[model samples]
Target: MTQVKLANNQWGYISAVIDEASNEVVSLNVSNHANKQQLATTLSNLQATIPKESMPILHSDQGWQY
Candidate 1:
Protein backbone atom coordinates (compact mmCIF):
# COMPACT_ATOMS: atom_id res chain seq x y z
CA MET A 1 0.00 0.00 0.00
CA THR A 2 1.12 3.54 -0.68
CA GLN A 3 -0.03 7.04 0.11
CA VAL A 4 -0.92 9.26 -2.80
CA LYS A 5 -1.28 13.01 -2.84
CA LEU A 6 -3.87 14.50 -5.13
CA ALA A 7 -4.64 17.98 -6.23
CA ASN A 8 -5.64 20.53 -3.61
CA ASN A 9 -3.80 18.67 -0.88
CA GLN A 10 -6.20 15.74 -1.00
CA TRP A 11 -4.66 12.44 -0.05
CA GLY A 12 -5.57 8.79 -0.35
CA TYR A 13 -4.20 5.29 -0.04
CA ILE A 14 -3.66 3.00 -3.00
CA SER A 15 -3.57 -0.73 -2.48
CA ALA A 16 -2.79 -3.18 -5.20
CA VAL A 17 -2.36 -6.90 -5.66
CA ILE A 18 0.21 -7.80 -8.27
CA ASP A 19 1.29 -11.00 -9.95
CA GLU A 20 4.95 -11.29 -9.03
CA ALA A 21 5.80 -13.83 -11.71
CA SER A 22 4.27 -11.85 -14.57
CA ASN A 23 4.68 -8.44 -12.95
CA GLU A 24 1.07 -7.66 -13.77
CA VAL A 25 -1.44 -5.87 -11.68
CA VAL A 26 -4.27 -8.18 -10.80
CA SER A 27 -6.27 -5.78 -8.66
CA LEU A 28 -6.22 -2.27 -7.27
CA ASN A 29 -8.23 -0.22 -4.85
CA VAL A 30 -8.14 3.26 -3.37
CA SER A 31 -9.55 4.76 -0.23
CA ASN A 32 -9.28 7.97 1.72
CA HIS A 33 -8.51 6.08 4.86
CA ALA A 34 -6.24 3.17 5.58
CA ASN A 35 -7.76 0.41 7.64
CA LYS A 36 -8.29 -3.29 7.85
CA GLN A 37 -11.84 -3.11 6.62
CA GLN A 38 -10.71 -1.21 3.55
CA LEU A 39 -8.13 -3.87 2.80
CA ALA A 40 -10.74 -6.58 3.18
CA THR A 41 -13.05 -4.75 0.81
CA THR A 42 -10.25 -4.33 -1.73
CA LEU A 43 -9.37 -8.03 -1.51
CA SER A 44 -13.01 -8.94 -1.92
CA ASN A 45 -13.11 -6.84 -5.05
CA LEU A 46 -10.06 -8.70 -6.36
CA GLN A 47 -11.64 -12.06 -5.68
CA ALA A 48 -14.72 -10.99 -7.57
CA THR A 49 -12.60 -9.97 -10.53
CA ILE A 50 -10.59 -13.19 -10.86
CA PRO A 51 -11.85 -16.70 -11.35
CA LYS A 52 -12.05 -18.85 -8.23
CA GLU A 53 -10.16 -21.71 -9.86
CA SER A 54 -7.26 -19.36 -10.61
CA MET A 55 -7.09 -17.58 -7.33
CA PRO A 56 -3.52 -16.67 -6.43
CA ILE A 57 -1.79 -16.39 -3.12
CA LEU A 58 -1.86 -12.90 -1.62
CA HIS A 59 1.15 -11.30 -0.02
CA SER A 60 1.68 -7.94 1.62
CA ASP A 61 4.03 -6.00 3.79
CA GLN A 62 3.30 -5.47 7.49
CA GLY A 63 1.21 -2.41 6.83
CA TRP A 64 -1.68 -1.62 9.12
CA GLN A 65 -4.14 -2.16 6.32
CA TYR A 66 -2.61 -5.50 5.47
Candidate 2:
Protein backbone atom coordinates (compact mmCIF):
# COMPACT_ATOMS: atom_id res chain seq x y z
CA MET A 1 0.00 0.00 0.00
CA THR A 2 1.14 3.52 -0.82
CA GLN A 3 -0.12 7.03 -1.30
CA VAL A 4 0.41 9.39 -4.19
CA LYS A 5 -0.20 13.07 -4.66
CA LEU A 6 -2.69 13.73 -7.41
CA ALA A 7 -2.56 16.72 -9.75
CA ASN A 8 -4.80 18.76 -7.48
CA ASN A 9 -2.60 18.00 -4.46
CA GLN A 10 -5.10 15.52 -3.15
CA TRP A 11 -4.06 12.06 -2.05
CA GLY A 12 -4.76 8.75 -3.74
CA TYR A 13 -4.21 5.29 -2.38
CA ILE A 14 -2.96 2.31 -4.33
CA SER A 15 -3.37 -1.37 -3.54
CA ALA A 16 -1.71 -4.07 -5.60
CA VAL A 17 -1.22 -7.79 -5.77
CA ILE A 18 1.90 -9.23 -7.35
CA ASP A 19 2.85 -12.71 -8.46
CA GLU A 20 5.82 -13.56 -6.27
CA ALA A 21 7.43 -16.11 -8.55
CA SER A 22 7.23 -14.06 -11.75
CA ASN A 23 7.35 -10.56 -10.27
CA GLU A 24 4.24 -9.69 -12.22
CA VAL A 25 1.33 -7.59 -11.13
CA VAL A 26 -1.84 -9.62 -10.87
CA SER A 27 -4.19 -6.88 -9.81
CA LEU A 28 -4.12 -3.19 -8.89
CA ASN A 29 -6.65 -0.74 -7.50
CA VAL A 30 -6.51 2.94 -6.75
CA SER A 31 -8.87 4.99 -4.62
CA ASN A 32 -9.09 8.25 -2.74
CA HIS A 33 -9.19 6.32 0.53
CA ALA A 34 -7.24 3.28 1.65
CA ASN A 35 -10.05 1.19 2.98
CA LYS A 36 -11.51 -2.28 2.84
CA GLN A 37 -13.39 -1.59 -0.38
CA GLN A 38 -10.20 -0.82 -2.22
CA LEU A 39 -8.51 -3.98 -1.00
CA ALA A 40 -11.60 -6.04 -1.69
CA THR A 41 -11.76 -4.80 -5.25
CA THR A 42 -8.12 -5.68 -5.79
CA LEU A 43 -8.70 -9.21 -4.56
CA SER A 44 -11.90 -9.52 -6.55
CA ASN A 45 -10.06 -8.60 -9.70
CA LEU A 46 -7.39 -11.19 -8.97
CA GLN A 47 -10.03 -13.82 -8.35
CA ALA A 48 -11.35 -13.32 -11.86
CA THR A 49 -7.96 -13.90 -13.46
CA ILE A 50 -6.87 -16.94 -11.50
CA PRO A 51 -8.02 -20.49 -12.15
CA LYS A 52 -10.62 -21.94 -9.81
CA GLU A 53 -8.59 -25.04 -9.10
CA SER A 54 -5.57 -23.08 -8.07
CA MET A 55 -5.53 -22.06 -4.42
CA PRO A 56 -3.01 -19.32 -4.00
CA ILE A 57 -1.60 -18.19 -0.68
CA LEU A 58 -1.48 -14.51 0.15
CA HIS A 59 1.32 -12.95 2.13
CA SER A 60 1.19 -9.46 3.44
CA ASP A 61 2.95 -7.29 5.98
CA GLN A 62 -0.20 -7.67 8.06
CA GLY A 63 -0.93 -4.02 7.84
CA TRP A 64 -4.32 -2.63 8.89
CA GLN A 65 -5.60 -2.87 5.33
CA TYR A 66 -4.70 -6.52 5.07
Candidate 3:
Protein backbone atom coordinates (compact mmCIF):
# COMPACT_ATOMS: atom_id res chain seq x y z
CA MET A 1 0.00 0.00 0.00
CA THR A 2 1.08 3.60 -0.61
CA GLN A 3 0.09 6.97 0.73
CA VAL A 4 -0.27 10.35 -0.89
CA LYS A 5 0.33 13.44 1.13
CA LEU A 6 -0.08 17.11 0.32
CA ALA A 7 1.47 20.12 1.99
CA ASN A 8 2.76 17.99 4.86
CA ASN A 9 -0.70 16.54 5.41
CA GLN A 10 -2.11 13.13 4.54
CA TRP A 11 -4.83 13.41 1.97
CA GLY A 12 -8.00 11.46 1.21
CA TYR A 13 -8.60 7.78 0.73
CA ILE A 14 -6.98 5.79 -2.04
CA SER A 15 -8.51 2.71 -3.61
CA ALA A 16 -7.42 -0.12 -5.85
CA VAL A 17 -8.53 -3.42 -7.34
CA ILE A 18 -6.56 -6.63 -7.13
CA ASP A 19 -7.29 -9.89 -8.82
CA GLU A 20 -7.92 -12.47 -6.15
CA ALA A 21 -7.15 -15.37 -8.38
CA SER A 22 -3.67 -14.38 -9.50
CA ASN A 23 -2.69 -11.72 -7.00
CA GLU A 24 -2.24 -9.28 -9.87
CA VAL A 25 -3.45 -5.72 -9.83
CA VAL A 26 -6.40 -5.15 -12.08
CA SER A 27 -6.87 -1.45 -11.53
CA LEU A 28 -5.83 1.40 -9.27
CA ASN A 29 -7.19 4.85 -8.46
CA VAL A 30 -6.57 7.75 -6.11
CA SER A 31 -8.48 10.84 -5.07
CA ASN A 32 -7.70 13.77 -2.86
CA HIS A 33 -11.42 14.12 -2.36
CA ALA A 34 -13.04 10.78 -2.75
CA ASN A 35 -16.68 10.98 -3.85
CA LYS A 36 -19.43 9.02 -5.52
CA GLN A 37 -18.49 10.23 -8.96
CA GLN A 38 -14.86 9.26 -8.44
CA LEU A 39 -15.77 5.90 -7.03
CA ALA A 40 -18.27 5.28 -9.79
CA THR A 41 -15.79 6.24 -12.49
CA THR A 42 -13.09 4.08 -10.97
CA LEU A 43 -15.43 1.15 -10.65
CA SER A 44 -16.64 1.65 -14.22
CA ASN A 45 -13.08 1.73 -15.46
CA LEU A 46 -12.24 -1.39 -13.47
CA GLN A 47 -15.21 -3.15 -15.01
CA ALA A 48 -14.09 -2.12 -18.43
CA THR A 49 -10.59 -3.45 -17.79
CA ILE A 50 -11.90 -6.86 -16.82
CA PRO A 51 -12.75 -9.26 -19.57
CA LYS A 52 -16.49 -9.35 -20.11
CA GLU A 53 -16.49 -13.12 -20.21
CA SER A 54 -14.52 -13.35 -16.97
CA MET A 55 -16.45 -13.17 -13.72
CA PRO A 56 -13.91 -10.85 -12.18
CA ILE A 57 -14.71 -9.25 -8.84
CA LEU A 58 -13.65 -6.09 -7.05
CA HIS A 59 -12.90 -5.95 -3.37
CA SER A 60 -12.57 -2.78 -1.32
CA ASP A 61 -12.33 -1.75 2.28
CA GLN A 62 -15.62 -0.96 4.03
CA GLY A 63 -15.08 2.75 4.23
CA TRP A 64 -17.09 5.82 3.30
CA GLN A 65 -14.83 6.06 0.27
CA TYR A 66 -16.78 3.25 -1.32
Best by TM-score: 2
Tell me the deviation in Å of residue 13 in model 2: 0.6
Candidates' TM-scores?
0.78, 0.90, 0.68
Error of 1 at 41 (Å): 1.8
TM-score-superior candidate, 1 or 2: 2
Report each candidate's C-alpha RMSD, comma-separated, in the order given. 1.8, 1.2, 2.8
Clashing pairs in 3: none
| TM-score, structure 3 vs. true | 0.68
Q: After superposition, how far is residue 33 of candidate 3 from its true place, in Å?
A: 0.8
Could you tell me which residue pairs clash in candidate 2?
none
**What's the C-alpha lDDT at position 60 in model 3?**
60
Candidate 2 on 1-66: residue-level lDDT in tens? 889999999999999999999999999999999999999999999999999899899999946898
Superior by lDDT: candidate 2 or candidate 3: 2
Per model, how many backbone clashes are there?
0, 0, 0
**Residue by residue across 1-66, what tens digits does model 1's lDDT show?**
889898869889888888799898877888898888778887888888887678577777848667
Q: Can you write out model 3's per-residue Cα lDDT over 1-66, one digit (the tens) per residue? A: 234677858676566777777888776777776777767767887888877787754556757655
Question: In model 2, where do residues sit more than 4 Å from their true spots?
Answer: none
Backbone clashes in model 1: 0
Report the error of model 2 at residue 64, Å.
0.9
Better of 1 and 3 by lDDT: 1
